[model samples]
Target: MQKREALEFDILFVGAGPANLASAIHLQRLLKRHNATAANPLEPSIAVIEKGRYAGAHLLSGALLDPRALDEFFPDYRAKGCPVEATVSKESIWFLQSKRKFAVPFIPEPFSNKNSLIVSLSRLGAWMAEQAENEGVQLFDNTAASAPFMENGKLTGIITDDKGIGKDGNSKTNFEPGLLLKAKAIVIGEGSDGSLTRQLSMHFPSISAAQRYETGVKETWEIPEERITAGEVHHTFGFPLESDVYGGGWLYAFSPTLVSVGCISSVGHDSPVCDPHLNLQRFKLHPLIANILKSGKMVESGARTITSGGLDAMPPLCGPGYLLTGESAGMVNMQRHKGIHLAMKSGTIAAETLFEALLHNDFSTGRLKSSEERFRNSWAWEELHAARNYRKAFDKGLYSGLVQAGLQLGIPGLSLKTTQLTLPGFTETPSFNPKKKKIALPVIPEFRADGMRTFSKERSLFSSGVMHEENQPCHLVIKREDIAEICLKKCKKEFANPCQHFCPAGVYEITTEPVPALKLNPSNCLHCKTCEIADPYGIITWTTPEGGGGPGYKLS
Candidate 1:
């Protein structure tokens, strides 16, 4: 490894997405206020690192519907150059059965607007990054942060793969070699279920792995002239065989020529059913969806891992010298399939909390925990809480059946009211149960030499005949006895089987076949690990390898 000079900063922000950018802006504003009033103006140096080549190039969204969080964070966002492609003119939910379609209107409380605006997240991210840079925040793209740097049980900075460096040592001094970033504090906005955040949570047992993830596979298409206009968004609950899965699909037409379509599934580590992409393809073939896309052409396709582990699944938001925000801390409203807004709100609150901590010269867990409280008090938390129980209802086959039923009645009011009324109560009592019967499988080492060697040499592996890339080598090893002990001691098979239905990659295979086995094709694995948490058996564990070994997407 090449040695290089270390850099110092007061705050090192990991990730350049909406969350990080929002925090950067808020921090600068707070500093300005502090400097204006205090005797000594504290100018805390801050830097933001983004793995993507550009700030928002990798940020994904399905035509963000009117984000109330945006209004709360930046009341003047529209006036301040936020781009709005088209205002949503029509919002309807559909329940489809083969060739028939049922449509109903949905109204989430307080968002009385039947028409919400559609936003281009790429443009939005760029704008936010620009604002951060103008406020003096250093931004570095294509810089991948792999782990948090720690000293005496406190976070200081991060270890990153310096992408700017060249082999011949002729690159810019700032990008010349491997270096440590020592900082007074670090804010992680590394997206839903980021590896470093997971590691940090592990270091602090108060945070549970259960508060983890969901997977989203989305594609953008160019709509034909005969189809719907820009400013229309559609959601569907009952597809051809709705009885089989717990997830649904969505279509958002941002422009007459552009539409975003996608699906989200619940998956666990031990599941052996459903591929997200395959589901999406099946969704497209649905009668209603087929007609919409009949004239449209596929433009972009990608996938995202989301944090849907809910309030109970949340990780510790703060620790000594470090703070976790956005998806890293499980701050997503899965019911709405929206996270960007929550991420931004959480980032803003985290920045404020940290700013206050700086004034007190305290960055300990006790002090940083204020961020978590702030988040809990915010509307984001309330919305997530409200939708929390709905996941079970969704799994109970309520979404597809009820949604379809409401549509058939042609009573949008009934459909909307039913969802609104039942959502909160359902969350109060999650009806989904796990399957109790246990199927014995032969004990196997968690880490197999054969699997490692195959993954290391080929860079691509197949399990159940699906191809996926293993960008990183495996670093976790477990004895077969350990697996047996975990199964015998800690396993509890639940009926909902979150992992089986949730994975976008369809990596887990859950069946009662003798020796319930999960065949991992690392290539198809998005590394979301919803399965790991769903595994009551504690059969799954994740480890880091040479950095930059996960999926590389053009627009994920």
Candidate 2:
């Protein structure tokens, strides 16, 4: 085992996203206020660790709408001069099916707006990071926090995966167990549930794994002169050919020649069965969408997970010496596809609560519980509550299907508001069964294609550039008959196969024949691991590939 020097700080924040950055800023301001009168004030020492090499590099490649809540966090955000493209000139929602469409004009409600500004998120994330640094927050990039450092039932800091040798041939560096950094408290803002957060949450039984999630696949396109333009954003329901699917698609214009389009779907739902990439391709081929992309060319495509667990799905916000914020605690509002704002607000609250607790030198759950109360009182909670209600109706397919049908009816005064009365409450009823049932698996055909000679053999297909290593062969002992039985059992228990719906690269196939069997198209696999999460059965296991193999993106 390798030993490394230990570092310490007053507070340690995980993740460098908007929420973490906002918290850093707010904490600085609070400390400054409290220490103004002290003869020898103790300044709060803070550190933020980011897995990515650059702040906001992961988010900047995409486009986002700037919410009004941004003003509450950064009053001079606009003046700071980030890469804001355009203020929304027009906003309209469409209930769409095939060639028919209905336009619904919704009035702005608190925390909800149709006319928000379009921004370059990559730039925005970097900007927030800079602001945090300017306020005396230390940042550690290219370093991942692997686990929380716990001592005597309190979170002190975190362990990191930071190991590299110097450029000189003789210089050598070895992997070291992360050093413990003692702090008064810690804040976990890790984006989504994974190995570390899962371990931490398990240690505290108050957190639940029932928090919901949805998969989002997005593609950016660069087209000709007449393709897409600024100020035009399109939302479509009842997508072409796949009218039975409950998910919706979007087309947002960034530059005159660049358009961002994608779809978001629930993880485990049947019907409207189609691959996300194929859906994007089909969406582009739609007469309405095609007309805009007539001369356009595909630029890039990516996928990410969205948390939809709502208020009921929230994890315990505070423990002995830690607070969970952002998506890590399930603060996303799926109804509006808004999470960034909520993440920022939650982080701010956590920081404020921590600052107060520090003043009294009380970091117990009693003092830190204020974070949860603040979250409930904020707009984030209200938005999540509404989204939870909307999802209840959405689950029955009544909300989206009826809205689409209503739009197609073309009644002059018809509007989504008119159907609001039909929306179901969160506690309405159980539309799905909790118990698993036995079902026959569909049979899939074998395609004997050379893996190396596959069409998608291009260098860009597999490398994420973030973490790329050579693939290694694995030798495992599992009976073939047992594997078959497990696969069949998984098909019955896990509703809505993830391989069929969420694969952005079209790697997995779900056959509708004799028995459902998953076919893997290794060549098209982007190594995104969505299939791994979507797999109710632990069938999809990943192994490191040959060095330097995988998709390499300009921006992810």
- Tell me the spans in candidate 2 whose CA falls farther than 4 Å from its real position: 1-4, 60-63, 105-112, 162-182, 240-244, 269-274, 398-467, 471-501, 505-529, 538-556
Q: Which lDDT values do the candidates have, in the order given?
A: 0.62, 0.60
Whole-structure CA lDDT of model 2 = 0.60
> How would you encode candidate 1's per-residue C-alpha lDDT over 1-556 as one tens digit per residue?
4565679988889888788898988889889888998998888888998766567655666656446767766677788887777887877777777678887656554323354667766667888999899889999876667666777877887777643333343454544344577788888887765667756765676644455445566777776775887788787766633464556788877778778787765544443333555456666777767777775666556566666656556667787888877877777765566777778888899889979878888777788889878877888787767655444344446555455433433432223334422221112111223454554532212222222111111222121122222333332323457444433333323323334444445454445467654334444554445444444444455543333334433322
Give each prediction's root-mean-square deviation over alpha carbons.
8.9, 7.2
Q: Kindly give the stretch of ten consecutive residues in candidate 2 with the minimal lDDT sum.
A: 451-460
C-alpha RMSD between model 2 and the true structure: 7.2
Among the numbered candidates, top TM-score falls to 2
Error of 2 at 211 (Å): 1.3
> After aligning candidate 2 to the native by TM-score, how far in Å is the CA of 458 from where it should be?
7.2
